[model samples]
Target chain A: MVRVVLCNCPPEDANRLARQLVEERLAACVNVIPGVTSFYMWDDELCEDQEHTLLIKTTEERYPELSRRLAELHPYSVPEDIALDSARVAAAYHSWVHETLSDT
Target chain B: MVRVVLCNCPPEDANRLARQLVEERLAACVNVIPGVTSFYMWDDELCEDQEHTLLIKTTEERYPELSRRLAELHPYSVPEDIALDSARVAAAYHSWVHETLSDT
Candidate 1:
């Protein structure tokens, strides 16, 4: 089954990362979402501002490689990268993801 | 914990559903991503076209309610609503999710 990862990055850097992911074909599809307001405490100060979110589509076999690549490319000291198995998805869509990635 | 659902919808009706979800508080935050191209089979025929993706953020307590509401409001007979628990997240962010939603 294809594994899914949900990630959020600063708006300034999100686009570049998305480009890299696509250029590498680490994800069959990378959805870039702008204007996401994220609220969290950074350095003991509560902050809320616009950011970008990425929906990365890849297979479980490629997850470790993808995660490593993301970590190397990510700018944040601690980036948000959460991977979970997709329980319900169109069968056709799942097949597409598997077909899109290179053999791991 | 906040349950995450990754859903894709026909672009024409994505915004309306997003609005409904926000108004209903099914998701504390709903991101509407435009210009998504989806390829799949409908009625045994291959179809490929643009669509929109939604990143719904809500607590686990509301997953069932949100799924039910989405089904009712969704135009598609088989709407895509998949919930998965986040494996890695900032502690502060996790708390924010819990605080965002009302009890259950």
Candidate 2:
């Protein structure tokens, strides 16, 4: 199975973190999408932030490690590091993702 | 039972489709993310596209309608409308999403 992890990070740290994940083989591909405006209630106040979202493609077996490593490397005290399940995917693309990883 | 649908759309039509989904209550929230580069094999040749991705937040029960509606409104001959399972989500946020939709 494959998982697409969404990590909300500060704009400054986004590119570096994306590169790190791919370099470490934690993710087959990491797309650093910039220019996102996040609005939410925090500490009894509505706060808005300009953040970047990292779209990570990796296998289920490597998910735990990837999550942990992301938290460790991420700058946020409380990171929105959630892994959404890939209910469906193209077989060929899925295979290609696996082949790109180190231990596949 | 929330679902996150990823739709690959041309940059020009992304925002309109996102608003349509929200207006029709097919999705509670649609995040129109720009600056995506997609590469795939089409017709035995490598194809590259600069597109935007729509991250739609909706419930599992409404998924079929959402998918159908998206395809009908989409400009692509075959839109990438695979719904990724929301395996986990914050309780408060999930409830908030449901409340925003008309059918909820």
Best by lDDT: 2
Q: What is the lDDT of residue B6 in candidate 2?
A: 82
Worst 10 residues of 2 chain B by lDDT: B95-104
Candidate 2 per-residue lDDT over residues A1-104, each given as its tens digit: 67888777889999989999888998999987888644433442334567788889988877778877887898866566557877688999989888887574
> Candidate 2: lDDT of A48?
50
Clashing pairs in 1: none
- The C-alpha local distance difference test score for the whole of candidate 2 amounts to 0.76
Candidate 2's C-alpha runs over 4 A off are A1-32, A37-51, A54-82, A85-104, B102-104
Instruction: List TM-scores for all candidates, in order.
Output: 0.59, 0.59
Superposed model 1: Cα runs more than 4 Å off: A1-5, A15-51, A55-104
TM-score of 1: 0.59
DockQ of each candidate relative to the true complex: 0.17, 0.17
